[model samples]
Target chain A: MGLVAVTWMNCLGRCLPQKTRFLHTLKGRQSDQILMSPSLASLDLPDTWTPNSSCQSIPDIRKSFNEQTPTVIDGKLMATEIRSKIADQVRQMKKCLGKVPGLAVILVGQRRDSLTYVHNKIIACEEVGMKSVVTELPTDCADADVQNAVMRFNKDPSIHGILVQLPLPQHLDEEKILDALCLEKDVDGFHPLNMGNLSLRGREPLFIPCTPKACIELLIRSGVKIMGKKAVVIGRSNIVGLPTSLLLQRHHATVTIVHAFTENPEQITSEAEIVVSAAGVPSLVRGNWIKSGATVIDVGTSPVEDPSSEDGYRLVGDVCFEEVKKVASVITPVPGGVGPMTVTMLLVNTLDSAKRMLNFT
Target chain B: MGLVAVTWMNCLGRCLPQKTRFLHTLKGRQSDQILMSPSLASLDLPDTWTPNSSCQSIPDIRKSFNEQTPTVIDGKLMATEIRSKIADQVRQMKKCLGKVPGLAVILVGQRRDSLTYVHNKIIACEEVGMKSVVTELPTDCADADVQNAVMRFNKDPSIHGILVQLPLPQHLDEEKILDALCLEKDVDGFHPLNMGNLSLRGREPLFIPCTPKACIELLIRSGVKIMGKKAVVIGRSNIVGLPTSLLLQRHHATVTIVHAFTENPEQITSEAEIVVSAAGVPSLVRGNWIKSGATVIDVGTSPVEDPSSEDGYRLVGDVCFEEVKKVASVITPVPGGVGPMTVTMLLVNTLDSAKRMLNFT
Candidate 1:
């Protein structure tokens, strides 16, 4: 423990020594120096000093893996709570409006992952007492075919929300197809009009983008404070990183984004109290890079070779989970973390869309 | 000058010494001292470094008191050049296609500034050999009136672009009026559809918002070297600051935005090689706060008391001009700089709209 403290102090001294020297000095002498004092008059300094040490020397403390256990936040559990809340709201809406909310999911191809994801989304919708419809198209379907399906759902009064599974066939224009959905039923909030409204300060989109909203909810459910905290989002992809940063900024968090071409990515990520890693580059963020006790929401879900696994493949996030768990106060695991919550959020969004369409809220 | 430099260094040391030391060492000596550098340096260092001192520090460079410093990139002159280019293109289109580009300017209120701006736009349209039409409505005009005007422009084949002067009457729904304009003919780029397209990566709007475009043109004309430079935008207004930051980012400059709620605003602003201030707060950024030889674009147009002027009012930018001029290498003076370029860019957009409609380009 003493050696760990010493190395942690040295590491912090290397990174933020000038800013932390005064507190570090107090921390270095606190145990021995406080005992020698005639009275316990200066204990307040120890309290403040310890937190700083924990924050600045996260890497060193995490090295003692056996001693420091990682706190695993159950994103699945939090997502279930949200779903239950949405279900309750849906039940009330049904009693009031005599109509149930419905969601239409359009899958363009038979990509196994997309099929599995669509299946899970349908299950989630059913779990939350919402009607779900799935429309499948051939891999070589024309743009007009996709557009026609979207128009059909748009005009269907029973369908309150519409979602198109992503990574559409390479031949199709994804942007044009996504924009074709009626903005009113764009529960996924990927429609250009909804995205534009979300970017504006005073205007709130009828449906907040699902993944970013789920990330925020996960952070709050874990009791991680967000107001006035510094958050860094690594990636600026429109789907996840950019919108996530904007949502965090709306909550008054000072936010910075480090994208692919960003120089010194580690330095920027290290400064954040809340880090959202959506870069999709497996193991891009290591344990040593995070601030001690910082909350990490790992949004990446890349499949990597895992010979030991039954399927011979395993899902991983952008952060080095094994390493990051040691330092992060609350960390979301890759496969069961943001992925499950994402599907669950779609259900919530569908229900909300239904409520809005039925004028239940 | 040496004494000024020393005093400036001392002040920087006292105010943000960690940042100053980190920047000096990082830029001064190109070594990987990532872990050893101060936290301030880690936070304040721009993602990219520009070698030219003047280009890096616009707000702190010495200003030329000589009234005829012709070397300065005159925005007014460049705007004329752009207007002439548009005029030539319009003339060629008329000769080849047998039709002129038409622009419709809708003025909803009697605001003096809006009226003056609209009049200049109409004049610019005429100067470019494009057709111009003006529609005036009373201050108390209903929202339906504005929407009708936009719909009329949408249906009129001859009207290529429709621009409704901003700060519309309070009674009128601004969003509704802006959204009514045909997406293709939305010259102001304020429509949600255009904004959505702008937010998407690699997606270009049919027309960009004028002031931000003008700011970029000003920098380019001055040879400020945007590629891989550190750019900081102070403020996040949808019109100027946010869009300008995005444009700079698109040009491959590492961009950071410092808004009203940003902590350590000076710490972030002073690190950038190029600074764009559009906060609308007078003197929010002081001279010493600027990087030496950086290019400063003052987008704020605030009216301040000036006994020397006959009207007892003077137009000023968000930056404190007299002080910053001594440190900045090149700066856009409030009234003549960005202001003139904005009006001129609007004409350019209108002209482009006309050319597209006329099948000229």
Candidate 2:
């Protein structure tokens, strides 16, 4: 048929020349070149704002927009370089699958801040070499003792990850012990089908809830750039502000949230560029609810009785970190920020649920 | 103990007097009295802005904010008064349980707009007395012939809502025939555990997706006071702009969204008071992206090529409706807007999944 429409117009002119040079560099560009093209920070974007084909490039988006000072993201040095590369991939999957990753926990009572967050998640699952259990219970337990300790760690085949330790004891039911877990060892993604496949858009959420995956792994290991910016969040809680505003609209930004019946929450967090907060309600984000450069994060902690330390009480967050680290460009800090990356993203979601239950990739 | 701290300060002076008159009517008021107290229209609000104790009162929120002229929002006369009140509740559940609500539908190829949307959802389940089937298949069927027609209406006990009809032809497997339908007969809520319990917060979503439950039942049957207002939404599309921005943040507003990597989306939808749009991109929301007493709700249609009338092309939507009915004060009209309230919210989610599978309530 006329040589298949001239060979399909020369195979769509070689598969559409990089989407016609990314729509001819977004024609007559200037909305400050699509807000300095941090991949056009989105909420549900993706209509051709290519930007050196993803993952920041134009000189690292002009050195994160001409950096001047602020920065401080750290999150305990990116959770010690992501728990030292998940403890060298759990010592190379226990030297080729002799079995490594486990992580159970149930801990119904003993609230000394939930026994120091279950002893710092059993010392971060034995410093990443993995395998750690728990159970605990008492302090007037019984909702069938926390769903029989979550159905015995969901029939523990060397428990790939379970976790229960939340604010469990007010005559316990806690959504019937988090609906007796086992949505493949939930890993604390707070299963409602893993928060509905982390708020669906080509669904994919096996586990994401470690303080909103340590606030998007401290904004992608601090290179920042959450596509088309303007975030916000603050707090909606269901474990850290509604899955960190559904993981900042799956890293396409343009989020918003705000909370506590947002009357003017500092004029919607002073028109954010990325805020977060997670209002546990201490400072409740201040420094004129920032916007000067914005990055923030905070994830609110809230203890506050201090009487000059020595365990009288300390903690505090929801930003006001020295007045939002002087108009934030990037901030983090409350007691080594996002609290040691929420126990290093629960040992990286229990070594990715033991490499997807030992298939070990 | 000092007369028991004076009888616990006279029982905390009679249980904190309506939270001290809702925090003394929110101290120095003005932030336009908490955005004119439509129950502090929120995204996550709820700290205490009592507003005549909920559900619109202040003279119907000042007569829907001093109405002027625009108010269209008919949705085909609210889908014929919600399909005549779902045909008088499916004829009072077929005179108390003789059984009526069925609604199956599978429909595979002959794509004349998926056979006119499974022939208008089998003529709106036989104009609501209910029971309607339709299978169709063939366009080179097999993905186990559309997952055995969704496991024969998930083992039909006279099926209580099934539905498959979406763009299903290009080599079948639409998410494994929608994960082999039957999360309590899904009734098209596009289950990700019912969109993770409709974006969690005291979860609850057995079914919702009929065009975001007819755009939140035409803004709560037109009273239109989605708490703490600021909305926006444009498009995210997991069927109607991410479940109508998670049902307008579960009716607490403060949303945002804006898509196609929004740069200024008309300066964030002209600082929204509730926008909606759904970007099936026809006119794509203009009239300075509204906000003069906004409340838009387009839900785009997009047909275009009109050779004037029938089968030539007509549809249209995504707002331009005579330039957003001159700066919206409440608009809708795109072929009687939101397409007959998405088939009257699929016959009110097939009579609420046959009154939740005959437990009948």
Candidate 3:
């Protein structure tokens, strides 16, 4: 593994541009210099270097990175464009068919994040000329009660799409409740049928899960050429990583997935032309781990302390942004990036569901 | 790719015993010395060679191999054992419940291989004490006629399982016919709802597709040690390869699927500790492409011409048996391997279906 890592670093140094080459060389020189500094050389060392020695080089590296250029993906703007197209289609459908698309959101409990997400979805629905209905259940609601709610929505003619916010109360069976949603009405595409259909050759589901779809859309709209490119998706969570890898494969990308148990994730990530980091651990993806000029989609939204913020909290993506922005050619910012696109895709799915159900062109 | 192949051959040679080593060297010496003795010097070849390259070296190789013998897993015996268990359960169920589990097989047109396969399935059902019904449709049968046959089987109270042999005459809508089968009686597990249910993390379908289930069973029964192992499934066909890979992953194997159009499949397959080849392409898997001592489940059954056989044909698996058997620790023979076990699993699924529906355990 160490040999592979060294070989890959050498390869990258040789392959990158002059500016990136200088930075990488300087970073390496400084790190080696710090290790051989007077204070470090005087002390007995363990098998591995200590945090203090590692930290000695960080301040200088941070100063250098701060002056580096930032490459933005403009996810919010791209999402808005997609939403407007969907809104226009919805308006045309309503005008010709005399009916508006409807989305039914089932919220089991009041997880703040879930509440906020649902609220954003409702706003997006309204923005897209679709009707939104919220069915909120108490925290102590029984599994049967939630299932019945889904069943009601499944039978309702007006409800073209249904979404049950995930991480349901511990007592309820998540799989059973989700499976109860009709395949056509399952806008989230978490249902196994949709996934199976997606995995099959020559088959496409009525709806693809939003986050993955949005990730691809964002990349394509940003002019990232994907055909025959190498993509590494770090994480294997069903909702994000695995499906995203499959979607990329569908578009002819050679995708390798690096999960938590993977032997050497950094090496794999560095080999990819496109990297999608969904591992929720903050700052897990470092700048050096990324290939220069590669597009990074940071899907992780970790809440970290920020004294400058009004709430003393800030949402940081999985990538160490300060460092990664210097290396990545294009990257999606944590708050304004994948989050908005996800909500927008949900609106599109709901509208599509309605159009399909009503046979509205 | 060439370097990897050379490394694999060296590893195989080094891993073998002194006798095997001697045999290989002897064969090389004899082939070059005896068969090409006059031409050896002229051809600029080594003097050490043999006529029967492999055969001449076997005795000494076998002696050394015996000293450091690897565990041999008998897939044929294990499959038969599983079938016997299913047969015993079916017998007990029939006696106690007073109703034998029934499987209805719908065969469209007369593809020779399909006919032989369906016939074998019927025989397997009878051997397991389950009722088997075959509905054969003419090659020119209308789509509606096929659908009508499926509907009849779906409506039959005695039938607990329904399976339509694939590649139904090109004119038939395969998806529609598959979807029409009652979800409860979809023993093949191809129904969209069942597939959807199977894809969820915690959700288990009433019936998993037979061949994939058989692959898992073969691995478990052989004590192949799949947990956390890197598995590569070659092919992504819905029926065999894709579902089998997913099932392996569910059992904690880190699975990589190499399908058609996948670049450098040899590199990927060689890295996998366990290989499942179901590409239906004969001799597609080479011995050098497999990791040392890997377990290979060959699910392909392509019939090739053989003048020696009464039928003027012989069945061959996807793996080149002559070459792969020398390297693979355990491998399934084409006809007796996954094929028999697949039919046995179908019986088990039918019986389970009956048990679930009748509530007669």
- Candidate 1 vs candidate 2: the DockQ winner is 2
lDDT of 2 by residue, B199-307 (tens): 8766667777888778766775666766567788887867778778877776666787877665566667767877888877777677766767788988877676777
TM-score of each: 0.77, 0.34, 0.77
Specify the poorest-scoring 10-residue window by lDDT in model 1 chain B. B32-41
Alpha-carbon shift of residue A184 in model 2 (angstroms): 3.8
Provide fnat values for all models in the order shown.
0.15, 0.42, 0.20
Give the DockQ ranking, best first.
Answer: 2, 1, 3
Go through the candidates in order and give each one's C-alpha lDDT. 0.69, 0.71, 0.70
Model 3 spans with C-alpha error above 4 angstroms: A1-72, A148-158, A223-230, A252-257, A261-273, A286-295, A305-307, A322-330, B1-73
User: How big is the positional error of residue A344 in model 2, measured in Å on the Cα after superposition?
Assistant: 6.6
| Residue-level lDDT for B31 in candidate 3 | 19
Q: What is the TM-score of chain B in candidate 1?
A: 0.77
The worst-scoring run of ten residues by lDDT in candidate 2 chain A lies at: A32-41
lDDT of 1: 0.69
